[model samples]
Target: MSDKINWEYIKEFNDSIRTIWMPFGLPEIIDPSHSRFSNGVDIQPAWKIPPKIAISTTITGAMFSSRGNPNHPMTLEEISKSAREACEAGSPIVHIHVRDENGYNVLDPEKFHKVIDPLKRDFPDTVFDGCMCALDSAEWPHMESFLKEGLLEVTPINTVAVLYGDTLFAKPPYSMIEKTKICQDCGVKPQIAIYTDADVDNADRFLIKPGLLQKPYHWIILAAVPGCSPMQNPRQMVEGLMRTYNNIMDIDDTASVMVCAAGRASSYLATFAMLMGLHIRVGMEDTVWKWPHKDDKIVNNAEHFKLFKTMAGMLGREVMTPDEYRRMIGLPVRKK
Candidate 1:
């Protein structure tokens, strides 16, 4: 009895396995009605929307300087020129991190105005947003002034503290809430910067669930940045992004997710986001290299936009226009 095989038990087990594996029975064609077709009563799923991607170019950020790229825009004129080039390359959203005469990232209203005012005059339909600068109290006044002057149409609010090397970029719950209120009060849209999944939870608990952040929430899922939540492995980074995105969608189904990175992996992450019907942000702020493994540097923000446009074309997705992006993100289209 111990040596003999139990053929009856083996057959039963095999049948059970097959039943579990093929619950619906071997890929038979189903009725169109049984498909995800919108019935008369139920709302159509968001995936039904055609593939259109908003390309947001971060013209400059805390990373790049004269040290990284000799042509990295440091002056007002240079920054303005870079931003204009980005728009010409079909980026509807231009993200700025205004640098002073010394190239240090600052949130000065006047400094920002110098770069933005001219761009606004030229690309009236383009949306402008900027880095909030480490979530410091001293920076809030400048940010508020910038918003009040209508220089910025969108701004980021980091949800948690992140260590970019030894420096801690802190965003306490109280400060983040305050920042959200400021954005709301100033009529500027706030996009939450998520460095990790914890940041997403923090955003939900502090900004979202409390009714501070309303429907159709916007998010920037940041990854591959050093000293924060770096996912250097491509597979892990994609999986991490998927999880982070799912976490956000779990909380708010209507939330718009954008993917970005701080290294050579930026382009890949952006591509993945586009394939998933999400948005993308790319520029010198995220990466200076044209390719992940190559040393070929991106000479300007326009280059990033051009490459992103080509990728979008290859993916069968349209690059969204400035006014189209504005409407999608709930911003008013600017009049020329």
Candidate 2:
């Protein structure tokens, strides 16, 4: 054997990568005659996104309209419009959370219509993902609550889960697989989210026969929750995610991973996640400040995305556009 390693194959593989931008593949605006839905609908540049960064608008300007918007409140039409504008800025997967009439936290499906309706109307081309978090109990009895009171009534264009520690099952914990079934039944892909390694393990553990859990999940690592995960150890953050994703892949090769942000990890872990060939998720819900070091400074979701895009460029990586993301994730072509 030659002293040179298998370098030829590596070079060929590198050369095989086809990199190009797929602009919405539609015409531009001039004297506007149609209101988007007219003339077979064309996807515009504004409603497009770089594939690498799937901006999670949940915590940013979602649910609530503005930073100063009152608690126990619902998002205003202007705020939803702003969120859609942010989507236009470049959010491949727009993560949405609907505010309840209570105004403190997200509500069940009662207001799901009210929230998703405007977003669908505005960002018809962008992929919108909704949340289905069971904040109360997780007993067999509570399953119905999550369905009847939580995510049953509404049919999201897409569904997401935020299963957290100490929120549902404890002592070895259980899975809310029922939620995913409901979502699949509703014809929406589940945007499954996890915080810790075990949470991901739970997802990995329950792929096929889910008695109480969801399997075959589209995973997102929401790094460092307010009280659950600490933001100090970036290395630990990477190691834990590496272990979890690698472990899941080892068992089931089909699991797709998304690296999400919460607070300071939102600022720092962007590169590490990119290094792992994963996507980023940042928004107001995950973090309120622009960067970890900045003192109480606020940045909007789109701006945060631009920040991450700059990081990717500095590191010599290409951020995927909306069309690329849809193709990569096996999602359908977004209609204009």
Candidate 3:
């Protein structure tokens, strides 16, 4: 079983990723503001994030709050501020969700620059992985326009998978082809996020799309979600990922994938994901700890990191620092 797992192969890949995101100098610490949807509670303090977390070819981290509310709705005003806080907290790359004046999630054409402009000015150092919500009635042309004009660094998500099977995009602003072309034209990497082992087919369809995917793509596994089926068996889950990765590698040896598990099952899935040489995304984005079960309700950010750390240690995986992350992601170094 140990030989079958390919621990050495996985470790070599882990080391390469670490070398890419080597450790770097710490980022600035700033004051945090209200989280508007925090039920009106104050935002988590700036002191909450450590000075720096991990390193690769450059030191880097996936910056986030210990108690960030996954259930919280983000506004442009709120997201703009929230994103800045993450930047100040030493996150070079920030995953974003745009919100509106009334705090509803809207994708109005006029609102794009409202968040991007000011954010670029204040936190120029941070790389923004801008997003357009699939929940909203967003289309491909709109996605195309966002990439061409928004000047966003990366798009952490895309509607390509949603486009293949759903009839929901039978209207303007939702053309599947143009959205994909814009991404290729813009050279933004798509983070393939899936709900179940079967959903890996979504990624398969992505490869067939014209010019949507080039060689050497990145993928993410999203476990145990509502619309997506549940993965209760750890053995099946891990094995599927390995096989899926092998299949992707058959297409392109440079293919990469990661996991972002949901619910209480996240901790174990996260560990398994990392043990296999994958990146991580842990925050309030996926689950709310307000549920009754102690792990079900809200657990703090440190606990998640501790879990990640423990699993990585047991598996002989070294965490990537901020500097390492920058090189891996190809972000330019900050001038001192």
Which numbered prediction scores highest in TM-score against the true structure? 1
TM-score: which is higher, 2 or 3?
A: 2
- For candidate 1, the lDDT comes to 0.79
Model 3 lDDT at residue 305? 46
Name the candidate that leads on lDDT.
1
Q: What is the lDDT of residue 296 in candidate 3?
A: 61
Clashes of each: 0, 12, 40
Prediction 3 global C-alpha lDDT = 0.50
Model 1: colliding residue pairs: none
Q: Whole-model lDDT, candidate 2?
A: 0.53
What is the descending TM-score order?
Answer: 1, 2, 3
**Cα lDDT for residue 54, model 3?**
33
lDDT, candidates in the order shown: 0.79, 0.53, 0.50
* lDDT score of residue 41 within candidate 3: 60
- TM-scores of the models, in the given order? 0.83, 0.64, 0.60
